[model samples]
Target chain A: MTSASVDESTRLAMYRDMVRARDFEQRAYDLFLEGVVQGTTHLGLGQEAVAAGFAAAMRPTDMTFCTYRGHNHTLLRGAPMPALMGELAGRKTGICGGKGGSMHLTDVPNHAMGSYAIVGAHLPIAVGAAWAGVLRGTDQVSVCFFGDGATNIGAFHEAVNLAAVWKVPVVFVCENNLYMEYTPIGDVIAVEHPAADRASAYGLESIIVDGNDVEAVHDIAVETIERARRGEGPSLVEAKTYRHKGHSRADPGKYRPDDEVAAWLERDPLTISRRRLEADGVAGDTIDAIEAESMIEVDSATEATRNAPPPDPATLMTEVWADGGSEWRN
Target chain B: MAELTYRAAVARGIAQEMERDPNVVLIGEDVAAAGGVFKTTEGLFERFGPNRVRDTPISEEAIIGAIMGAAMNGLRPIGELMFSDFLATCWDIVANQIAKTRYMTGGQVALPLVIRTANGGGNRFGGQHAQSVENWAMAVPGLKVVAPSTPSDVIGLMAAAVRDPNPVVFFEHKKLFAAKQEVPEGEIVDRLGAATIRNPGSDVTIVALAAMVSVAEEAAVVLAASGVSAEVIDLRTLVPLDTKTLLESVSRTGRLVTVEENPRLCGWGAEITSIVVEEGFWHLDAPIVRVTTPHIPLPAAAELEDLAIPSSEQVVAAVQRME
Candidate 1:
């Protein structure tokens, strides 16, 4: 159920990515508390396995679109941690020059193509990117990540059906984290499996995985993404996961029953991945070294972000048009 | 030069761009097989085939989203919305996603895309189908707006819109589709935000767009018979608005009157009025006049719609009132 059939290198890399994502998110949350990160930030603390597994499976040419809780996904895709933190801190050295802030971190060169703040906006957008593959004769698949909440939105249905109709290469991953915001997802959605139950509506197979387990998530990602690259159209994979923190800076997450919270925390992605690595006969020294390296990387990123200057006022008026100016009239 | 119907010019414009660049593709409802709801896209599917010219279900969101995504990647795509009024259904994608993606992504992505929609009334499409929505795009930042009145301008501005590195909302007036004009031969490329003086005069400036341009010309003739020399300026684009032409025309005429199919109250005419009053304040002999349809939904009844929309007679009457 864990990293049993996976190779030592693959398992190690998966564990390392998950640890890096966890460490970076933890540091970002701390920065938010210290008032370094202005505005609201949605941290993907307990959902690193989904981001790490999907990133590991995806190729460099492949593109990804995620929600506001997207720091883990962006960093796992090889975006420089300093820039990601810098963007969160509203610094000039940020990936988006601090204009996009935490929710809109984008590194198109690294294939982490834009995080959307609006809910359900990126589902169809990712489908559009995949449509480029179909038109241009490429196998580059586009991956879209969202929560169980997004599955009920109009864009999710439109995007899935259109991707099926056009046979575009895209994978829609729904991280069913049990809660939409303060309410449980099961309370709102009519179906049992939020995404997988609706897959049949678009003529796709229902695939549900243990999102807390890195190997399971990676295996599903590799399969569906490959299916898309092969021109087999789109697939919807629902990963059952949980958010360890509240929805945003404003939420204290008191609505969640204590037992449910304790149960999900017990299956934290980093802990699951590391325990699996140790069970696979990997040395404790090797496992400990990866965690230590991730800590050092996140620490330096935090330091660099704090020291960086805020974006110049000139950046405020730039990038409205591709001509490199916001000016509309001559 | 040859005479080309405004509808035929739509197909010709798309074909010319698609011929020049392999990246240019067309997507929308009935665009591929049925040649668009207005039949403006005839022969495109046949010429470009299914690869370049694709059709979709009535999924407006998907169509818009597909073009935005393609533009982000490599292809220069064009989406033919059946009607401009349908922009309401997918306003989120058009206004939020396509308009803001480049700016939000910090300009890493270039959205060289065009959304061509049939705009304005004449066929009496009721309130839902008939609307001059260039104002809708004009109100939003990060979107380029273009509305060509004549077939010649259509072929020219369509080329410019497709070539632009930003998202452009192209308003093709449905009423002008049947009208014909002499289009010059070979590769007509016109710049956006450039105003063309259709009929130059001195006494009063008549600013018009799309269907209203011809109406303005008709009123200019009636005004000429009455000794009021009215200048007719066709504003081809709205976002990169031809403010210089507007100010220059208003300065020369000492009076500004705008003719538009959009209802009054916050129409593009209001913005032009604000600009004229702000910049050309000293040049005014009287308050700026706006000859527009009363701010109400266009009725389904023929007589009601015709009476509600501004006419050449109304333009003449408004000019007379100004006198």
Candidate 2:
């Protein structure tokens, strides 16, 4: 069951999710350029397959945590396009009511807790969530999605060790996208396969998968996630992939060689899925139709965000504490 | 009423809360099997078992992070930092995650977590282990900072902290662990943002916090010997400061003196100075005097430690200097 084959329709649905994420990123980038969206955005331009495949494998009740580059993950995890886009645009109707912006997107009803901006910080939180499930004796598993950079931090090690010691149900997904914001993983991390090596140190099973391959990611994620749900303890899955865009809103790709960039771009998740669909005797128009629908959805989301009202300044002081409490007496 | 030691009061408060709510739990290094280094969580491990009372690794960041996560998931976790100085090691988690989660989420979540840690000097635990850093939590907008001087107040404040729907940093003084006070038998809870006037007088108003409350009391006794009546107010909770009670007392007394064990500059005492000068300036008959430890790190030696910590003599001198 670890390498189980998924049905063709299900595969197509996952491919469509990748396209949705891609289209949303492109549209949001355009909106950002036009000043419709406020604040910097961390786009997962070339890392859509991991998000799409992981989302496809998880139960809605299973909780997930993400890094700042979380737009794709939140969307695939069932955040409404209007609310997600509204948040990026700082609208009152946003998922977090416009207070959290892009770096802190959350959809608790869908069970994706948040996108913590700090590196490696959410690992312990995810461990705690998984521990809660263990205490309840439930089948719920927590997935913590972080980049290659987070692997070196103290929290990553501390949380993973605790999870393994307790035998809690969690899957630490390390999306090894090669670069940790301009610095190569090789420069910072010494391990050949970080997640695999780190996992063994903590007595956890590790799996290495091609992150750009939607089918592969879905297969491996399903296997690990199911094991966790069955209380088989925590595991680490490293998905090797690359980000086609710059690190964030401002960076340009002067640091990377053009050949390396061209090589990775050719293996883009959307292109790979499209070629697979064509070879499977699926009509080309069917693939084109999926892409067209995704574009329309993203464009409409942008239009709605433009018309959405700005966050009200009058309620700025509200919600600092649950009971509207303050540091001083009124 | 029952007489309990300060540490015993803390344990009873937690045990009672855990008995009432199954969701309430304690997690920290040496808390479970070891019963905590200071024995603040003594016998809790045996009472609740491994599930409720957890012993975590020496990871302050993870300790705080787990507390925040557990609380968000509908459990109330009481995390122990061992020493208040260690708050710097996990400041990111404390300041960013636990303190700001509910606010950043736009009230979609409530933390309902308490971080209990030993603070203040008098033990020869050196600068790192014996300092009081309540100002770190007090400066953060979303945190509630509570410091209790006596066993009764410890029991009451612990009950209040665990029940409040916000993150509260409950600072326990290491010096007062063996100190005994009368505590009511069951469920004694104090209001978080209210001050208790330990002694009332018309000559001067003396506001003290945590360990300094006792210091202020001794100073008031000395002032009484000199025929100068002094009012002493214990500002139990620093964040949701009982500023109104403070202003009212200062208005009546027409003189103000604040005492705290933290450094004299920008400490809890400094905060009171600003509040009094801003609100009760016209009511004040003399300038507000703040009695605090000198602006320096605490020393390990006994003599230097005594000099660095605020004493009853300093509080009295500040009051007499006002006269």
Candidate 3:
């Protein structure tokens, strides 16, 4: 049964965001196949709940820094789908003005720093942002999203240590998709549960959650985010999940076994959330309506991106220097 | 005017800026209690407190990344890399993030940050410690590079760098930290991208930077004795090069000699020469000469280290060769 205190409209809004993320990713995959989108894409096909759940619990003023596999993260952070699709299409109308492709989408107004292509590069940056917020006496909290592989980077250790020592208001969420590219988690990392175990090492609070369960992630994220806002320092939320797609467009995923993909797909967040929604006496027609509307939204964004203009040659010289002096000109 | 060493002047500049702007802070190794490896941050932690003047671990990437993040969030952070050679560890953040953030952000953000570090080969600190990497920073577009040779210039230029709205790389020559001069009292601001004429002469132009400015001045004196009047131009800032002053000096002299402590191959000297030939070709008489260190790692032995870097004699010889 749906919780009595949970407002129906709020639940519907969350469902809408989930559908938006799923539809956006599906459309992105279709466009990739159609050769309309260039460059490699890392799809969040099944892990939509983690981004939707966590982002829903956050305030618009809170900052987020994510990794390259961040399409869902950007979408859930309130970025316009058209801008994201336009960026993926390499058009000037896109976020970052098409300079940064999918892996580097940034919308500062929504408090989303660019998703760094380099693994673990944004860890220290997130920590620094949190430190600035704390020093400035702001209640804002900064969130960092990275994969299990990023835990091995030197920046992760250094950043976490500094955050713990300074008691900076920040949360580090590791989307442990059970694989670092093609290598299984157990093969590369010595620790079984990386984020939970690593957080304690830095003397910070740690929580482990079922990343596929939207309610489960939302509950824990709400607590940790509040603690950070209260200046209780940083916390690590290890969300255990799996990626439905290959690491990038190039990989056919021959490395993973068929049974493994089938097992993860069975517990996909979107399907689970839909089942929960239907079980709560949401009409089948309403579900269909939501799906139809999301499809329309995604389709329009695709068309808009298709017609978007390519960056002008003169635009390349711009944004390099803040003074507008063309240093590239010989 | 107050008499101070180059290191003390730099320390005073940082301390004063930290007091002036709450957003301006200092982060580096041993900057808090120990006053930095070169004492360039002396008494900063005591004066500004640890929150503003913080000590960092030996992680160069973290230091630079923290600075970039803080700067993006509207803070003027002056990060120190201790030795210029250590910059290699954080090259990705410096060359990619800090340098490209403003451009990539579509001018929506400004990285008003400064990275100050000591450089040069006179200390015999071995290959890892001694280096003149100004050329590497000069290659980056968004970064403004400054290397002051005197205490007066150090104080003035550092104040300007802290107030600048763009990222800057302030290269402090370790050998010149103890060199003393009269620093002006109160606040002093020197314009970035402007070269200072150290010695006005008529025969030839000698362009130099960092510790080499003193070498050029000494060489000018030596040249004056031989009836070769050499104009010494200290290129205080490398990236936003003051081509106007350099061209004027070169045009009047008709001969040019660039000197640097870094290796000759692909050094700042080459960039100056190319710019001169491109913009002021008609002013040239003889081929532009460059006096630079040999392309070899600095040895630990004092004698060998002395041989590795350029000296006043070498600069004088290069000027003579031009004649």
**Model 1 per-residue lDDT tens digits across residues A1-330:** 645667889889989998898888888888888999888889888999999889989999899999999999999889999999998998998898887888998999988888888788888889888898777877789999999999888888989999999888999999999999898989998988899999999999999999989899999999999999888899999999999999998998999999999999999988887777777789999999998999999999999988999989987788989988887775
| Residue A281 lDDT in candidate 3 | 88
Error of 1 at B106 (Å): 1.7
lDDT of 3 by residue, A1-330 (tens): 233334666566677888899899888888999988888798878888788878888999888889888888888898999999998888888887777887888888888877887888888888878887767776788889999888888888888887787788888999999888888877877778877888888997667889988877777788899998987888988999988888889987788899989999999887887888788889889888998999999989998998999977687878766676546322
Minimum summed lDDT over a 10-residue window in model 2 chain A is located at A1-10
RMSD of each: 1.1, 1.5, 1.9
Off by over 4 Å in 1: none
After the best TM-score superposition of candidate 3, give how far the Cα of residue B260 lies from its true spot, in angstroms. Answer: 1.3
lDDT of 1 by residue, B19-65 (tens): 99999999999999889888899999998899899988888888898
Winning model by lDDT:
1
lDDT of 2 by residue, B1-323 (tens): 87799998889889988998888999999999888898889999999999999988898888888888778777888999999999998888889887777777677778899999999999988889998899889999899999998898898889899999899999999999999987778777777988999999989999988888899999999999999999999989997888888899988999998888888778988878887888888998988887788889999999999999989999899888885
Standalone chain B TM-score for every prediction: 0.98, 0.98, 0.98
Q: Say which candidate scores most in TM-score.
A: 1
lDDT of 2 by residue, A1-330 (tens): 222387888788898999999988888888899998889899999999999999999998888899899999999999999899999989998888888898998888898888899999999988887787777666688989999999999989988888888787889999998888898888886788767768888887668999999999999888999988887888899999999888899987578889999999999988998888788788999988998998889888888898899888865888888776443564
For every model in order, the TM-score on chain A comes to 0.98, 0.96, 0.96
Poorest 10 consecutive residues of model 3 chain A by lDDT?
A1-10
